[model samples]
Target: MNQPETNPDAPLPRPSTFPDGLRVQVQGFDDQQAADGLGEQLTALFVQMGRYFDIQRLDGVTIAIDYEEALRSLDRGCATRELAPSRGRTVGVAMTPSVLRDGVLKSHVFVDAAVFFGMLKEDRYERAMQLLAHECAHVEVNAHYDRCFPDTLLRTKYMNAQQGARSEVILASWDEYAACALSAKRGENPEADYRETFLNDLADARERGNECIKAYRLHSQVGQIVREIREIYGGLMKHAAYYLGNAAGFGKSWRDDPAVAEALTEHWFLPFFERLETALAALYAELGVWPNHDGFEVIGDIGEDLMCEGGMYFYDSPDHPGEVGVQLPLTPDTVPY
Candidate 1:
């Protein structure tokens, strides 16, 4: 949908200066050597991101692989504490095989351990770096959002499973989009990076030898889905709005009826979806890109029907099939990198 172009020349907003104690821990692996190696690598990565995002004052971030402890921390309501106002911090990293195969769903980050091991096995350090960078970007985005609009975006919980799913899809799109943009500039291979990280490792060698074959295939399939969603649908901002809006409308309808308050509370995406569009626009502008019709178009193809389908549709559709509407203005008058 079309929105007024965000001024490309606008000054970028800086990340938070608050001292949120960010930490990362690894779990499910028994090999001390592997755990230590992963921990060191993750620590360096966080340090780099902290400096880049200007969160130095934030308590040092941690990376651990203690699946049991991580689960315990999460089960005993660790997220409640982690998300507490006074102790606003995030914990996550490249997940181990066991965690991915059989861990309770948490809001925590999950990196495919097999994929990670595959990258390491293949000696694709550059690809591994890209994966690490992508996960780290999520942390940066989450922290930035928390600091900038804690009440509006961070506090509202998704009202239903549908809304939650929609929010997640959009969030994942943006995460990958940002990661792709950053990785491209840094000379990283997105496909190889994802493939090696998600598909190449075995989660259960004894139960299912060569099991990763199917998992690897599935990874490739999902990777393609994400790419198609970005290329065909449009940018993350537009797609996210489409799903989030529907979810929000659904939640509001239920909330208006007191009988469904419990159900609504359990299933809304409002918490994360609320203000997501604005936040994305701000981020796009900060990155020096215009948040105009053309920018959204390049992110994906939003036709008249899909545009109208969402309440926020703003861009004009093409006159005919297989055509672009208009090119949005970008900063520096140069092509998008």
Candidate 2:
């Protein structure tokens, strides 16, 4: 008997849990009073979100206030590199196991101590709560997908090929949209935050594209290395979609904005993004009211449209023999560093 070949880009296994039933864990606060206060805040937040979202699968879930420590705890059973926190608007994250168990993700949430406490120091309690709420919404979203699409491994299949990767990106963008939409509906103003973040991500995506071109041209290790390089850019583009998702969820338009136009100059992403936004707007219109098969098809249609319009995907490189070749919307000459 032989073992199956594993997908290198597949998500690692989930973190181990203790027998203790503590749902909120706070660390690094010197004063016990401060730690206790933070614990109460987190517990209350979870309770509030759980009630509103009707989330009932939080039995094994844990909320860690210290991100580094939380990542260490989450990385314990994994052999791969440690998990990293997102460095964007909200430095918090929610994660689930690589595979669902009993149609539940049992997701956990982690909040960066520095960001959370920094906002507290500035008396930005509302913003800090908003960040936590956004992450909580992510946990709900994960659970919803896991339960609704129990047999699917879409996120885990991201690195299977270009279509899988693109699907992964679109799914991630949808997750952000759903999360932000939930938070916005709960009285947090994610729309205002997205108004600025979207342009920043556009500029970042532009720079990433330029760097990818430069690296692709200069590197001798174009086979495996180029594939890795493309994935790096793809990851950044995935984050850029987060902001784009924000716009769609909030019904905000950036097409007429001068800053967005300037950022997209000499860039080929505008049309693709417009198409994605249209797909997302459709999804947004049906949020929280998924109709079984129709809901799944609605999500699937976005990927179909994305692949159809872009004319870019990962394909086996016939020219390079064993290597993977990618076709992107932008050419090497699209932007020069």
Candidate 3:
């Protein structure tokens, strides 16, 4: 018997449960008496978003809190950075998993309830809820992809091909585009001005990275690594700001832009690296270490298939394997410190 090859980007075999509405659950927050109230609000907000996007649904989300022992005490399944309590603006982490809980396969989410409430009290109410909505969008996308292509093997972005990504990458970018644009449709703030916050984060990361690059100017390896990180992430940040700022029409706001619409629908990565690579090569040719190699190939040793934190997603780069932290995954699985 011959089964047809499955298209990696093919739609899910089954329909989404959104028509029935999604569900949410909270765990591990009893210690912080205030956590329950926040959890309840977050859950309600997520449910409302489900009604809005209505494309895919999560089985259920398991949001947990751990604020007493460590100010930041949560980590998602495959975190690229170690989380510490000292990191200010602390909010608990979240993740989506398809694993057995008590010997039965359960897929859900976990979050830090206390940290979330703290942010809420600080009047960051809009941003806090938006983050939750973004994470849910991620789970919804991943959940559907997992079921349809349960055995699909994806490569880490470490090689050179350009412009193609895994279903996972598409999932990440789509949700990011949607999450940012969703503001016009479902948020308390009509335009959801918080989208600019990501640009601020990007500027901070790049500025800090530039400082490190200058400090290690003589260190060839260090310089090259820093350069790569900036170029790859810079493109995503640029696109995120574009998608978020463009103010797409309500209901799948990402669709408002023809480019974003087609890129996501066709399952391709925008921000072609060639231009960025060319600029980088010219900028660093004086270093005399980059030209010796064809293109970056360190992903095998360092890249992880998935890295999640609320707004940022570091995963396989579609065009080239061995690259992590390039595409945007909206569903950020957090780690408890």
Candidate 4:
């Protein structure tokens, strides 16, 4: 493996290898038998997901086992450094007691190693799969965004404007949700069963006015705020269902009623996408950049446009009231050289 060229006078360049073409390298293991076993398992899982990334399992991709090296490599090269570095460095999975107890899945993307050895040691195959899927989804999403979004907007607008939030996280969550949902629908293993059970319980809890269950599961929040939001949304949804069912004579099963479904589908999903668009637009505005329709055609683009328009143009005005946009502070401080 080639080591990153370090220059104290300049920022480091991002790693250029594509995830699909990269190979996995393992280190710190005592024997070949153990490494091979883990490699085969990972290959099988990757194949199952229909991801055709080249995964060469070798020993000694890097001298250090930690992820910081890869992160440093990314920070030097990429303008938007967060998701790409972490997603790009994952190579192999290892078992570590600390990770297991903390429920953290660490990736060394530059070296192409991801550690799931901890989960496997605990016999948590299903959870392991979920984590793998999540990380892989990050790579996929980042690739898609790179291909779809313009390079100019990505660097000047998207990278500079959006902070703390990651497209990888959004994509990963959606992937996990879909995978878990499919597994549950198919009556799969323990992990799938748990996900399905959780969704069902959330549904039940929402019906019974159980605030905790409704909020945490639906909006991905913990504690009172989640509960409050869930309660409000659930109540609104329920009331909407009641009104539609009564008007349509669809009986008490409005949860599955077509009318209610139509309303939520038309109202909720579209608005959600619109809000995302507004947020992205606002971010662009902060960077003094504007996105053309070509780059903003898809969901990611929509998000960018929304942020720009809402944050930069419509914020604090009743004429464009309720327009969602990015909330970046004006005149951001210069990043240290």
For each predicted model, how many residue pairs clash, with residues at least 3 apart or on different chains? 29, 0, 28, 42
If both were scored by TM-score, which would come out higher, candidate 1 or candidate 4?
1
Candidate 4 ranges beyond 4 A from true positions: 1-21, 27-33, 40-76, 79-115, 152-154, 158-337
Tens-place lDDT per residue, model 3, 1-337, is 1112448796553443342444454556555555555455655555456555433435465555553322233333332233333233222254443332232222444455555556567777665665565556555444444444343213233242122222223333333444444333333443433344433443344344344444444554532443444333443443453345335423334446465455445321223322322322332232223333222222111112211211222455577666543332212122201
lDDT of 1 at 254: 24
Per-residue lDDT of 320 in model 4: 55
Residue range 30-138, candidate 2, lDDT tens digits: 7868777767666655665565563454433444556656676663232434667655444445453332345434555666666666767887766766776676677
The residue ranges of model 2 lying beyond 4 angstroms of the native Cα positions read: 1-22, 32-34, 59-66, 75-81, 87-103, 153-159, 220-241, 244-251, 255-267, 287-313, 316-331, 334-337
Residues 77-107, candidate 1, lDDT per residue (tens digit)? 2123222111111123342111111222112
Task: Write down the TM-score of every candidate.
Answer: 0.40, 0.69, 0.45, 0.35
1-337: candidate 4 lDDT, tens digit per residue: 1112437796423432233533344444677687666555554444444332211211112322454544344322234434323222122332111011122122233333444555556666555555544344334333333334434223433332122122322332232332222222111133323323323432333233333333334554333432243333333322232232222221223246353344446442335333433443343232213244332333333333322322221133345554333332232221111
Best by lDDT: 2
The C-alpha local distance difference test score for the whole of candidate 1 amounts to 0.37
Worst 10 residues of 3 by lDDT: 298-307
Candidate whose TM-score is highest: 2
Candidate 2 CA-lDDT value: 0.55
TM-score of 1: 0.40
